[model samples]
Target chain A: MAAGDSGEDKLIARLFGSVATHPGALGLKDDAALLAVPPGHELVLTKDALVAGVHFFPDDPPASIARKAMRVNLSDLAAKGADPLGVLLAFAIPPDMDAAALEAFAGGIGADATLYGAPLLGGDTVRTPGPFTVSITALGAVPTGQMVRRATARPGEAIVVSGTIGDSALGLALRLDPARSGFAGLDSASLDHLRDRYLHPRPRLALARPLRGRASAAMDVSDGLVGDLRKLLSASGVAGTIEASRVPFSAAARAAIAAEPALLETALTGGDDYEILAVMPDHEVSAFSTFATAAGIGVSVIGHTHEGEGLSVRDGDGAELTLARGSFSHF
Target chain B: MAAGDSGEDKLIARLFGSVATHPGALGLKDDAALLAVPPGHELVLTKDALVAGVHFFPDDPPASIARKAMRVNLSDLAAKGADPLGVLLAFAIPPDMDAAALEAFAGGIGADATLYGAPLLGGDTVRTPGPFTVSITALGAVPTGQMVRRATARPGEAIVVSGTIGDSALGLALRLDPARSGFAGLDSASLDHLRDRYLHPRPRLALARPLRGRASAAMDVSDGLVGDLRKLLSASGVAGTIEASRVPFSAAARAAIAAEPALLETALTGGDDYEILAVMPDHEVSAFSTFATAAGIGVSVIGHTHEGEGLSVRDGDGAELTLARGSFSHF
Candidate 1:
């Protein structure tokens, strides 16, 4: 049987059958899956595609690639203040992708889907002569009319971010040039931390409820904090000033920047930091921070929104910082 | 600005902003889209991916590629008896894909999304080093617990297919070798008919309401009719017998088969025929066919289900015919 015929069926059944735990998935046999929305809820839909060599190294660990594919879209749901309902995967496997690699990739998706409470609903798989690609459409649910929007931020709001920033970008830099001396002073543990941050993103889904209740606007920071904040502010028709010194950084990221002061620019302008960025009323910041802390996630006030347009970043000395590029663009 | 940053924003706004007509789409400026299901409806989800040089020729018209991508998923919704709500797209554009091609591609998507009432909700676009790839996830709605399934056909149900089969597979054959002598006797109109059938699929969405009310089992015939029927039967835990002579064929398909007798098998087992294959109780077949006719779509009763484990096809003389292969497989 050709792969798209019986072969495709066998591959889907063997690799992903376990993940189709939702009753509506029909054991992956139906043409489409069914999902019921709660009476008072609305569906949140987000899709993100990751291609080998562009989004990640073609030789990256299969599990890591799969997890990143799923998490990136999950991050959008989290930012939208929605709880994951399920995910549908569209995978195009290159000729060089082996069975073992595929198994590992499916395993990673299943693990995350289970852990995140988003069971596999349904999906399509096909062969590709190009790079292995995975595109995921994640469905989430929020109470009717309560999804946080990036356009709702107002002047005088505090710009807050979840978890440390720049770690993923720095980690990507380390991965791109393993022998670079920029982080030579860093210990193996620090190096590992950077690499792990690059490999796996922690989507701030735990803060969804708090954000829905408190955020004036929200978005996930995937395209670097500076650029993403700029977009948020642009969408909201406001300007923001980022206190560069106040931008949260992991110990490893801080050490790497300490060894190489210029790496801070890369950290600020690089992409793949899947943390939540939100604008909240100034009075609600403290309460939101307390809620985040109780949930074991860090929330930092990196900037504040002011009435205007365009973004500005100021150093501790009040000197303005200029970046050649704001975020990574695939095009 | 990197294409993923500002470049992507401008490209999306210029190309697809008009298709984001749903108020919940947030004018395509938000991280995710919101969709509220009707109070008594369940969401039906399906995803399909198309890769250049794999699913379609790299040089195929951009509009056709886009329509096929959207229609393939729409076919699934039709098969499930669900009305389309919206669709999410994940596009990976290769370097060689020029601006004009992209404009045409986006235009095609916009046109189909509007015509089908499945407006573009949201999507993610990125650059790829490989061939252009499109992944679409379509969401549809059906009354709760009323979705037609592939696992419900009984031994007494009639196997019916919409439109004609084998035209697309033959069209592909002609495309693969334009100078091939087997189809030499075909007129220009016939050849064009076959090619068009292969390039574009007419999803039987108009039959959704009737199928929901009448079909015991349903699925679209993307793969060859024989193979797809086998799948439907297998899922329903029944066997079936297809009367090869009774299978519907277009004038062009008939002429092509007459010119090359062997083309009959190609027609029987070729894929890309995006017609709905449904099984209905013997008593319901007439009313369903009437409904399909009233909707201006053709419905053919090609076979009947039986209490067995595998599919068998009978020739005009009631002799069993063996097929070398059943359907087109992407793997």
Candidate 2:
């Protein structure tokens, strides 16, 4: 009940007020914001939270942490085929955090808010006796009844994925232990590629229009492609078959797997890719791919849906591949 | 990017899914939710964060914590003269929080969501190595361009407040030290009254419509009456005078103040009283009061606005009173 004092108020206004460009934000001075949902559109809502030592390294750059938090929520909106509206941030600042770090964090959010057209609407900031944490709730808009759903995929649809997968997982591995075995073969560029993928996510917002027009079901791959696909299949009450060879990977990821064959499982099941996994009619694959190409996004058909209740992965030799773990879970 | 594991997913579904009754929630099976804004209405958005050990007692009942968290955000919406639409929760669970406590917390949210007509739409949950925290983003709807603002109070307007003040601050003091000298004369019923007021906040949602129609400016009294009134005055570029004797107080608060005259300052400056403070033309006060009475909420005219630059509080004999601190500030 002890609300924000002048110190907290001044901190928020100085740090975040500039990004709240939407008039509805009331210049971060009001108790709430007003958003006019575009006519004939429905609002899409999603929230994601990141904590130090869990989602990212405690010493990671403040800008990177802010960008990751905003991107993760934006990725959900993209998967739902919704255009960005705005975002609300709930920030918990550890006592030891410095003013410079907070300024950098706010700068990162402002940068992304501009890049993605998701203006900073309003937010709350509080002191915490724990690690620094950020929780973002992103608002989006989609034409009425046009939001792509995870439960609408039917049997015999082609399963499509946008952008390369597994890079982030390998990047995470390199981040965890850069000198680990098999990584000795990687060149500096390849190592940087893997690491950058882990540090920053590219939310496939450009694919929203195409997905809304043609996709039967869709969701972003945050918890690994295989596990997330399983979730999608479960939601749709169907089964899926993924061709391992068809799963697109960046050159860096391919090099990492080539050096360490055991790392293939990590690449396939590791999370944080933030790519869109979508389902559409088999006949519409070409059209969807064309749209993706026009938008400068890479699209790959990795598998297909069928009338079953689980997922199967097949290797190049037509042999089934088994993963040590389906996906990374923060249990 | 290390997404939620099966344990986290199952925990969220089992503990919080039942309350996501909005059709747009898709039974909490999707990554995001879809909400259709009623025609001719705009969305009102607000977010608030509560951290364990800072915002509330860590050992408080799980249900009480949940209700307080939810009500604080809803209170913001009510102040905007909007009706509840839905909410998204971002929860970071401490390592030691138990499942039974989580269930009770979710139960509390469900009860309030039902009572206030703000169903849970979607949310995210993650394990944290920090204190338990809940960040809620509440959505509401108001007729386009009709949201009451904190920056529109004009000169000569009547400053009215709903319900009593200082009860929560007194309650918090009693809670912190039940055997404090000044509270020794308080009966058990009075003590409970103060404690319950601190634990639960009535949002005054029923007055939204009346405020939208009549109030020139409005905001909730969360950070004490004097400080919050200063904010409202500052935002509107005006000043005001308050009659100290006219400020409403609950029977328990009155008793506490009578027992210890010094406690009056604590009541005036103590935060956590979530009543509505509204401004309106002097002639409209009677109609506004009638509307509030019909809605079963108390209304008190305690002050008047004028073309000035600061706030002044006068005693019964017109002597100005000075406060050591204007409000409760966390920092």
- In terms of docking quality, how is candidate 1 classified? high
Residue A259 accuracy (lDDT) in model 2? 86
lDDT by residue (A71-124, candidate 2, tens digit) is 999999999999999999989999888888988999999999999999999888
Please name the candidate that would achieve the greatest TM-score relative to the true structure: 2
The TM-scores that each candidate's chain B achieves against the reference are: 0.96, 0.97
Q: List all candidate RMSDs to the true structure.
A: 1.9, 1.7
Q: Which candidate number would show the highest lDDT if scored against the true structure?
A: 2
Candidate 1 lDDT score relative to the true structure = 0.87
Error of 2 at B158 (Å): 0.5
Candidate 2: chain B TM-score against the reference chain B: 0.97
